[model samples]
Target: MALIAIFILRKRNSDSGDRQSSNQNPQGLFSILNLEGKLVYDEIVRATNDFDAENCIGNGGHGSVYRAELPSGEVVAVKKFHSPLSCDQIADQKEFLTEVKALTETRHRNIVKFYGFCSHARHSFLVYEFLERGSLAAILSSDAAAQELDWSQRMNAIKGVADALSYLHHDCFPPIVHRDISSKNLLLDLEYEAHVADFGIAKFLMPDSSNWTEFAGTYGYVAPELAYTMKITEKCDVYSFGVLVLEVIKGKHPRDFLSSISSSSLNTDIELDEMLDPRLPAPSRSVQEKLISIMEVAFSCLNKSPESRPTMKIVSQQLRT
Candidate 1:
């Protein structure tokens, strides 16, 4: 019901307030439905100790995320934007609003849950469900954590992302394009289930509108065509998903593997064993076959030509099979 109310508000304000200036003091512009604006705001500030460093959980290009536990014992992640909008902060305001718009529209099990957002003159932030295991990048960086993420868990993570992307690209009206789909944007729960997070640079592909936009995405996961085309498409996400797949399998960013592939020098006969993460033992026979199939689908997604890349729908279907 809150999501539905937010959607209605977004539609009503689409033409005007959606692009409102960040410098303006728009007091009590809380977009959350069914929650008292001032009450939730007070709870968040009190819980986070006024966004102190001790409460901080994660930091990103857009803002820092803090762990907040309300008086009701509900835990949430709060992404607070840096104050005093100037130059880059102005752009960050746009990104912040973009994320609010995108997340408010999306609803999927594999996608991070969006609770609400607050836009006050003093501080602005977005609230989301707290995920226990943090990010895939953090997990892969730790040997102990990487070992804990067994082959079966990794497979589920990959499929969850594919399913989320498929829903974003096809199931949503005006199909959303998540320009950034790097491992850092993928969060895991206690069960190792993957959830897609971060939509600071996401775009909605509206019909009869040019989807051209500035280049944005993690360097290693960015699509090759973006340098020249300057266009946003679902294929950009597909390419990033390819990189994520290999990263999950290799236990780190596959920079060298990506380079070889880009140079067209990658050996087709390269053994799968060499690509797997060394921290974990080999997967079972059935799981290995699934991994092989997944790798094939990933490679197809990373094709130099955007048109040649498989749609997320196709990739999701392939993974399911």
Candidate 2:
């Protein structure tokens, strides 16, 4: 597990004295939410040049991501929320913050390290450890990068995501359901290690509360059951993980293959070699067997019936073996 350094910015009351306290920094820009960390609010604004377009690295449904390099020479990814948010967007921001607070209590190696968040009147955003390699989707889109991510690395990436999901589903107190698990949400570090990111729609499965909600998650990766049922479960993530595994193996989205498999009742006569990405050379016999095993696990996870899909814990254990 990685060490979490949590920092939060709170609006100081107008009546409050300007004098800095032990908990507040000299600027009084941020307060310690949990653990230790001094995330100077001004530093981020300057680092991102007031969220200039040149600093922007990625864009998502919720907000844009910017790369901010602090004065200390530390690089981090900043997700700046769109200001003047609509009523529904405000609700989503609240849920996003709540989820971040819960995640700070638990840390996993395969999960992205969240430094903290800011909620100033001017701008609002979340900070996370930056990965040089970027998202899995970006890498697969490039032929050179895809070839660099060989079979061994791809397998490890799949396992890392599974382990992270397992921890989130079974280890967390209330158990978090990562509503979105597409390749775009999976990031890779310099060493090709996978880290799960983007919790914009994540939900906690509280035992006594209803888990039903409006439809969420990426289109193709979303569980088929979600289209008809508003209720959410960990199985949704498992199904997305199945799609991700196939995507990583194929070096692209497996939309056609997935459609064919679902229609053909998961034809067992398909050749494993034919299914693999052609960009790389053929794997050895031992590697092929492992790939076959992984594909089997992915297929099981993609079962049409949510009840038939295996839990992330089970999927993680299967990948480990």
Top candidate (TM-score): 1
Q: Taking the tens digit of each residue's C-alpha lDDT, what string does model 1 give over 113-137?
A: 9888766556778889999999999
* Model 1 accuracy (lDDT, Cα): 0.83
| Per-residue lDDT over 100-195 for candidate 2, one digit per residue giving the tens place of the 0 to 100 score | 654565599999998877655567678899999999999999999999999999999999999999999999977889889998999999999999
Q: Which stretches of candidate 1 lie over 4 Å from their true place?
A: 1-39, 84-88, 262-267
- lDDT of every predicted structure (CA atoms): 0.83, 0.81
Candidate 1 local lDDT, residue 13: 53
lDDT (Cα) of model 2: 0.81
Give candidate 1's error at residue 167 in angstroms: 0.3
- For lDDT, the strongest prediction is 1
Each candidate: RMSD: 4.7, 6.7
